[model samples]
Target: MAMARRLVLWGVLAACVAAGAGDWSPGTATFYGGADGSGTMDGACGYGNLYSAGYGVNNAALSQTLFNDGASCGQCYLIMCDTSKSTSCKPGNTITVTATNLCPANYALTNGGWCGPGRPHFDMSQPAWENIGIYQAGVIPVVYQRVQCSRSGGVRFSLAGSKYFLLVNIQNIGGSGSVGAAWVKGTKTGWIQMSRNWGANWQALSGLVGQALSFAVTSTGGQYVHFPDVVPAWWQFGQTFTSNLQFSY
Candidate 1:
């Protein structure tokens, strides 16, 4: 009976793994960048100059739901052309892309928002799309799955806007690199939730000019890291702070 129970458990685990793999859904893909594309800098996710830092237009913009209001920023995805739908797809070819921006809801026209309601979709950079599908096809069927992001260096926090309206951009994240939620606390105040304003950026509308700030971050994989007093009281707008804390895979 014990041996039979072990086999049953193994069977259940295999079924779970199969279900997870089947979650990768078919979707439509479109490309941007180059003359007709959205500019490489100043994306809705607040990531600027996507062409720099060796990324070089190898990025993508996801629709509202997929964007998860910036939670998907810095996340990676494995995308493959669905050859079953089009002859232009290269058999067994796939391209991995980093989510760097948000494709606004207005662009969703036919199939929910750019990455919304109906099916999963990716607005990839032209170069990234061409890596797996014929350029002339414009749009092609694809299947995508979220993957772990590989990054180096510690996490850095960049402050923007004014003291009353604070915006913090988290960068150089590691492990399950995308942030799911972030909270901030000042010297004397209780923890305040920060709302995702765009790619990698979390914002809070409060006067925190003179207080030292501590942060707590949760990653997509449910790992949490609390950075106590990561920012000094003297931290000023436009300045950046680095924390020694990081999430593990």
Candidate 2:
């Protein structure tokens, strides 16, 4: 029998690439973290340290509408300060950043609730914000576009959890960046499906210790990549492994 194609469940991501890299949409932006992005660690996407994760200081926490409940984690966006809407905009400048956190809504705050539900906003890192807007402009209007992530290396999987459970954090992804689904396979066993456990973490209930690990990942943009025996049988918790394979987008 012929094999069935994977289901296209994340059709929303199609809109992101509808017009390619030049497709810009209106939005608002504010800065967070210190100038060096030291305060941007341990974000909602579970990326403990952006610098260590190879994301550097150029990152942003997306508002609820764009965040899509962590599904947007790892996605990249190109944003330019809109000169037409704000005097503080530094024209001819744009910055690309990865989605690493959530700018949660604050219903209690009246004037400062730019991240409120349904709003398109970006709470960018200070360094990223300073790249396109004046420092004095606490918030600036911006035109943003979903862009492909250019990563320096292959995808990285950070392992955590106990013998009874396995929690994997996928990072350094290119292409669509956001993971839609994942499956883990052990050397001695067949492919085991994993479920999203918040942010970029995927979880598996069974333990496959002492067996080499492989992964099959599908991005929100419908791209798929597979890594075979990426982790040795001696893998341990808290250790990270890098795959030679990556999606080119």
Candidate 3:
């Protein structure tokens, strides 16, 4: 079945090749490693979608994943190379693409390790990495949000309420969320629950449960961890209501 899918994808790509646009538009979205191209993904596991500049409601679950080098933990990708010709670049070798195509905004790519650019016609994979996870690196349905804000149900000098929301922001890599968080002047007296839609549930965060890691999310720059909020009293405002998460494939 998987082979059939690969053949189908290859066939579609080949047709594009026939039209002299195999690498047109999307421009050869490539993955060169992994167990026989079983895990070379450029999108999310459940939500890999493409939308026009102004289209909405694009939430489709993905059927497969992209991987490169199954036995290896981490690998580096060098794309937009020289398109010069066939080459057998090794793990430590720097493969160059000779293709001369400008990178369109939607024509994006990412790898576990750092990649380079400026040259054209390139698509090679090498080994130089940090983290080792097959499910890493891809243009996913970045789910930035705010979820689970609460306060002590009944604690000393604290009141509780359960009016929560999962702030949703549909953004791409390195984008910021719509909120921020901080340790309210008086937050050593309660607890809350919050998280971006990393998995659709608010899991407790570490430290200063209510006021920890509270900072304005200028960018989706950290782990999509959840932090609970508190609404102790009518006038009680938890300064830490400003947290968010970023989902990457």
Candidate 4:
């Protein structure tokens, strides 16, 4: 009888341990490294992707886990630079980065393009995301996806007060009609026309030729023109349309 009682007790203990020792609660999933303007924005925005990111340190502890159950949040981001040099939240992005993290060391913050109010901004004026460090206690392996080429900022130029020739590479995603149009924001409302040299310098195609094409831009004196294909507006080339916006100058 004692042997059976002890066996039952052991079973009860095992069940209790199992109840309390479940897989560590998942924190906010984050994503880092790779081109920002690419489709990667979907993952960075926590839509869904191969990698994950974002979470505080030592999240497995039983106490701090009560702060948030992550019932409705699955967002994440950031990564270590070189595993030795810890200073500043060196993001893995390679384009125009506007750091919005109020606290740069603990974790990452949401991205609110252009510095506004207390939004953080990492000056892209020099080498970045180098010499990152990690700890053994709170430091755990997060997800980092290395998808897509960093081609967004490979050739972004602005003409503040002059007319310039720009060469646009046009490529149809699939169909054979309306290759789409390129627009430029001239420091005002509505997008202006982006021209192309048909045979000399630049050339732009109509909506009936290909899905992708380049256009020239001209800014009057004291006027600033920002290309529409700069950010957030990707060459929609997915379904019957896709854009291979390679370069423009």
Candidate 5:
């Protein structure tokens, strides 16, 4: 009797895991940005300007889980409209977008708050939404999946705030794509782990203004790279540095 009960529980657990691992999920999408071509500049993930030439205006804001509270920053996704639900959708058409911001929390007392109670959703830019569905639809059902980020040149790091605060933004990442973990070290101190501040930005609260900065990054796909002396000792706030290292897909 005991063995049978254990087996049943195991089977149930396996089924639940399988269901959660579905390749495609159903959700809703809405668009932001207008003729002025501006959306929220201070994305939860710390990206300051989404309309810049580097990031472009085509980006998205995802719900909390999808946003992973900033871990999903710089992540790429391929989203397609569900024609069965919205007839206006172009058959088999899809749009690729980079995760740049976080959708605001639903504050309603009922119906699970802002983004629909932790539901999978995308708050896309108007240009991105237009790629797969008619803008007139306003909201459309869709499916999306993570894909590797592709970019040219090396990875770049930008310093924000003061050197004592040590906020760094990692950009132009390539391969397994999104950053999962980052560590920083100065000339005198040992490796210091940095916390994700938002989007591609990470922060370490320490005083290392005069020491060079080196970094090690781990991607969401589990790959890792160590960049030594990526930032010179003279690095200062509001400055950007580039490293020749990147991850393999």
Candidate 6:
């Protein structure tokens, strides 16, 4: 009897730990980008190739409600097939994915648009979807929660745009990966705030050529990080810079 009592106590403790994890919210999920997730490349987040951006195949295109007009770019989500709602769920399985695109609503399709406006849906990469559900299910009821992103190395900045317009796509961010705001500074100028161009890209109309660049970024979670002189004076328009600093998860 004592041993049984101890087991019950352990079970209750484990349940408490699970409850303390991020609050699960209801949603639906579907697979896309083929079985290898190759079709998911060059998504709306401006991340280019998922592999090149360090997001790998574990990525998803979120519905408008969750996409937040690209403000949710680079954010991470923990998803699980809700076994209580579907028999196709791979029980006890969950996957973590990064938001890399938008699952636009298709008003033309009859009952086919799961990612319509106001709906919290995830059009996940095939590999990611398979991790938590059977392929035959196609679409499944799911529960997901926003979670801190886990990334290797530090953040990366890909530079683009023309002589007067500077566009930077920030990638491989950790913690709350969605960037709320960003600012750039040159060796000779004061901090110039950048505007969200689209997706994870931030733009500034200032000409900052031939100057070593630094950046201050703030996440949607309100955490701030600064990378000083991350780009050298010789930086080119197509160059990408890496910083050794990252936000804590």
Candidate 6 residue runs with Cα over 4 Å from true position: 1-19
lDDT-based ranking, best first? 6, 2, 5, 1, 4, 3
CA RMSD per model (angstroms): 8.2, 10.1, 17.2, 20.0, 9.1, 4.7
Candidate 5 vs 6: which has more lDDT: 6
lDDT of 2 by residue, 203-232 (tens): 999988888999999988788888999999
Candidate 6 residue-wise lDDT, 1-249, digit = tens: 445434543454356358786667899999899999999988889999888788999999999899988999999998888766777777667899999999889822557678887789999999999998999988899878898898988889999988788999999999898888899999989999999999999999999998999999998888899999999999998888889998774
Q: Across residues 1-249, which tens digit of lDDT does each residue of candidate 4 receive?
A: 445434543454345347662222221122233223223222111212211111112011111121122111111122223112222222232121222112222343234322223322221112222222122212222212111122222223212111233233222111110122345342222434655332111232223122222232332111222234332322332212123333221
lDDT of prediction 2: 0.85
Ten-residue stretch with the least lDDT total in model 1? 47-56
**Candidate 6: which pairs clash?**
none
lDDT of 1 by residue, 75-152 (tens): 788777766567666555668788887776667466554556544678888878888788888788887777666654
lDDT of each: 0.74, 0.85, 0.23, 0.24, 0.74, 0.87
The candidate, 2 or 6, that scores higher on TM-score is 6
Estimate the overall C-alpha local distance difference test score of candidate 1. 0.74
- lDDT of candidate 3 over 72-95, digit per residue (tens): 001112222112211211111212
Candidate 1 TM-score versus the reference: 0.75
Ten contiguous residues with the weakest lDDT in model 5: 4-13
* Minimal lDDT window, size 10, model 4: 58-67
